[model samples]
Target: MKRARTIAWIKGLVAIVVTAVVFLVPFAFVLLQAAKTPDDASNLTFSWPTHWQFFQNLRDVLATNDGLIWRAFANSAILTVGSVTIMVILAAMVGYVLQRKASRLNPVINFFVLAGLIVPPAVVPTIWLLQGVGLFKTMFGMILVEATFGLSFCILLFRAFVGTIPRELDEAAVLDGAGPIRLFFRVILPLLRPVIVTVIVVQAVAVFNDFAGPLYFLPGDENATVQLTLYQFQGQNLSFYNLLFMDILLITIPPLVAYIFFNRQIVAGLTSGAVKG
Candidate 1:
């Protein structure tokens, strides 16, 4: 018994050390690279920087082209929050309805959503449609597009999760003179806290990191998001490598902060259905 316990302890220590190193090594590289000069960054890729220029890089990047990064950052924040809000609320409501209804029409609607998950959007047709609708290149149009793309999966998660919630609660709410909307907003929705967190984190990350959607749908330089900020860092001849690094670093921070704060909540929300359902 003592020998087995000792072996188990040794194995646990090895696993912990390996896990730490796996996560730490890349971060160490990012920080080191962020501080280096273009010459050092390119020539000595993995070598330590003789001088750390974190603040210098940040200053130059922020001050570039009359503070354009600030605009990009603001745009990114607006897009992320607006798009994710639409995605999560719509997904939650649709998922809840599908879970409760479970009728023939429900199955058909679910099948159409599942089909969307499989079918790629036709880019040209979509662009034409948006132009026809007078929503092309507009912020709200992009927001709607992002929400539509995101909704199917969010709805799927909600449906799976809501299944675990008893129909008894719905019945009880009805008995208390609660209509569908009231029961949903007051009762069933509050119980969706865990899944809601999951949806928020997942959609927030997707929106913040989205390049393709914004690039194609909302291409104005003034309306550019973080991913588009890289364009400003580029030049015809010589590029500001340090400023580029700093731009990348600033763009990384929001998602990093979000992941750090909600990592546990997201995991709990997503996995809650495993046992509950």
Candidate 2:
């Protein structure tokens, strides 16, 4: 028993050390770079700043290109909120129906859902379609793209969670004269809290961090998302390493703060439907 306890203790210590090295070290490096003088940051070493310029670097990054970073942050927030809202509503409805209804088309729908996960998006075709629909370079268009891309995974999560819900609640709601909308909104959706929170946090972070989607689908500085703002500090001949790291640190905070606060909820949501009682 003592030998087993010793091994477990050693294993836990090793895991903690590995986690700190893998995650904390990179974050510390970025922090150090962001706080350094321009010359110090340029060296890109994991050393403390010779002259700390954290606030100055932050001001410069935020004020670059007439405060493009602020605009990028606003656009990213809007896009993340819009896309995640659409995904949660649509995925929940589809998952509920697919799980509850007995339809021959379920298999076909399932195939397409899985295909959405497997198939890489055709960017050229998507852009062409957006252009044809007059949605090119529009916020709404980017929202649609983000929502659609994330829908399949959200569906799978919702469907798995729906299975854990008893059918008696549905019958009871119907017996109480509840319509489908009310049944879902009032009765079912409340029960879907776990998976809903999971989907929102996960997908919101993804949409906010997405670079290529905004780069290709929503071009122009006005529509620039947070990830696109990274280009501001980068140039062909010159790069502002301090300001670049500052921007990265700034943009990384929202997602980091979100995960920190909702960490437990995310874990519970993800594992809640893993085993149905």
Best by TM-score: 2
True lDDT of residue 101, candidate 1? 79
Indicate which candidate wins on lDDT.
Answer: 2
- CA lDDT, every model vs. true structure: 0.84, 0.94
- CA lDDT of 28 in candidate 2? 98
TM for candidate 2 is 0.98
Residue 241 displacement (Å), model 1: 2.5
Q: Write the per-residue lDDT of candidate 1 for residues 1-277, one digit (tens) a residue.
A: 9999999999999999997799767666767777877767655366788888888877888888788888888888888888889977888888888877757798689788898799987778878889999999988888888888888889888888898899899999999999988999999888989989989988888888888888898888788888888887668987766667668778888888989999999998888778654
Residue-wise lDDT of candidate 2 within 158-252, one digit each (tens)? 99899999999999999999999999999999999999999999999999999999999999999998898999888998888999999999988
Candidate 1: Cα lDDT at 151: 84
